[model samples]
Target: MHVTKEQIAGMGKFERANFINSLSGMKSANLIGTKSEHGVTNLALVSSVFHVGANPPLVGMLMRPHTVVRDTLQNIKDSGVYTINHVNEAMVEQAHQCSARYDSDKSEFEATGLEEQYFNDFAAPFVAQSNIKFAVEVREIQVLQLNQTELVIGEIVGVLSNKDYCLEDGYVDIQAAGSIAVSSLDSYHRTERIDRYSYAKPDEPLRSIWKTQS
Candidate 1:
């Protein structure tokens, strides 16, 4: 269980990738939807989506080296917009299939049988089966020199979710929405609430928000 840097560097490509990816434990699984300038729609499953800032409502995700045809990245660059749809329990299979490398001409929505949805003429598509989704506009794209991976940062412009899942305090109850998490490259998991606590103050006892709210 003691894997040194040398050992890690010497591991097989697939083995190293899985090991490194799983080291981060559970990750948010989302279906990134985009549309080519020519109007071809694309869907890609990405776990790297994360919050960047709250004031500007920014989000970011990493794209693997662009040595190959990256339809989602290209579409976002061309169209300047994309959708992030949470992969819920019901749509896990279809969402995972989106990771497949399909020809740019073929829409993953059609290939996977996932319904495409749009909001107010948004250029990108959303997964109709997802309980929670959001629209993002590209703000920046930086290439990480070390690995050639691209860091795509965007601003969240709109969100779609069931009202019941939106809590009073601005927290979205993703677990209640049946949103699932992914580990490594392929494993899927469901989560349970451990409890919520109030903001911590130095030397102050933590208060259980769940108990007070309930």
Candidate 2:
């Protein structure tokens, strides 16, 4: 159970990748959709999506090293637009398949049987089967010097979802949408709504928002 830095570096490539990925615990599972400048669409599953800021509604995602060609990253950079679609229970299989390596000309949407959807003037496509989806415009790309991996930061421009999943307080009910999360690299998980807690304040006892309504 005790793994040292040297031990981690000495581990096999696949083993190290899985171990390092799982160490981050459960992460948001999303399908990143992009389109090449030549109009070829691509879909890829990514779990590294994270919130950067609320005021600007910025989101960040990590991409593997650019030593080799990366279609998704290239498309996003070329088009300056991408879509993040939450991978729900029903689309788990298809979404996971997107992680497989494919030729640059091959579209994961077509390879995995997922439907492509678009809205407004966005240049990227969205997963039609996803219950919750949002489109973003690329703002910046930062490269990690230690590793060649790149970090892409984008600003969310539009979000689409079923009205039933939206709460009075503007919170989207992810559980109602049946969205799923990922553990490690390949495991899929379903989540449940625990309890909604009231905003914390100094010198105040913690309380449940659900209890107040009941």
Candidate 3:
């Protein structure tokens, strides 16, 4: 199973892509919702969401190069707002179908049987089926010249989640929320609560703070 850089370059497109993407292991599966100025809604499944900073609560996601119409990116540029919704076990099928290149006028929420939700004055829609969702304001977009991929960074402005998913110490119980993760590009998996440990200090033994469910 050893693959060198030369071997990787020689591999077929699909094979090379799948292998490289899967090497990153599991990633958070999220549905990014946006709306055009004319009110057309778009939902796309993304797995590259990652934490950028916490002081200002920033999150970043990578969007594939614009080989075709990029409704989500365009909408965000036009409106400056979007929603990130976690995909759970029950929403896997619908969430995956979002990757299909539907007409820009078509709404994935309606096309895939997921309900659209709105809160406060957010300009984008949210997946009602998701237990954990948040709204963000577009902060910056950086285009990588090497690959032409776009890095979208947003500042989290609001959050909505099931009451049961919040812990007393301000942590989220993602496993209890039923959120799922993605491997490579297509495989979906349910996650389990392993263990949470306290911050490490010099001369102190690492300790687990996680509690087993009664």
Query: What TM-score would every model get versus the actual structure?
Result: 0.97, 0.94, 0.96
lDDT of each: 0.92, 0.90, 0.91
TM-score attained by model 2: 0.94
Candidate 2 backbone collisions, by pair: none
Compute the lDDT for candidate 1.
Answer: 0.92
Model 3 segments beyond 4 Å from truth?
A: 67-69, 212-214
Looking at model 3, residue 41 earns an lDDT score of 87
lDDT ranking from best candidate downward:
1, 3, 2
Model 1 poorest ten-residue lDDT run: 64-73
Clashing pairs in 1: none
Q: What is the lDDT of residue 172 in candidate 1?
A: 88
Better of 1 and 2 by lDDT: 1
* Candidate 3 residue lDDT tens string, 1-214: 7889999999999999899999999999999999998889889999999999998999999997563239999999999999999999999999999998899899898899999999988889999999999999999999999998999999999999977788888888887898999999899999876788888999999878886332
Better of 2 and 3 by lDDT: 3
User: Which residue segments of model 1 deviate by more than 4 Å?
Assistant: 67-69
lDDT of 1 by residue, 143-212 (tens): 9999889999999999999999988889888999999999999999999999999999999999889866
Using TM-score as the measure, the top candidate is: 1
Root-mean-square deviation of candidate 1: 1.2
Relative to the true structure, candidate 3 reaches a TM of: 0.96
Worst 10 residues of 2 by lDDT: 63-72
How many clashing pairs in candidate 1? 0
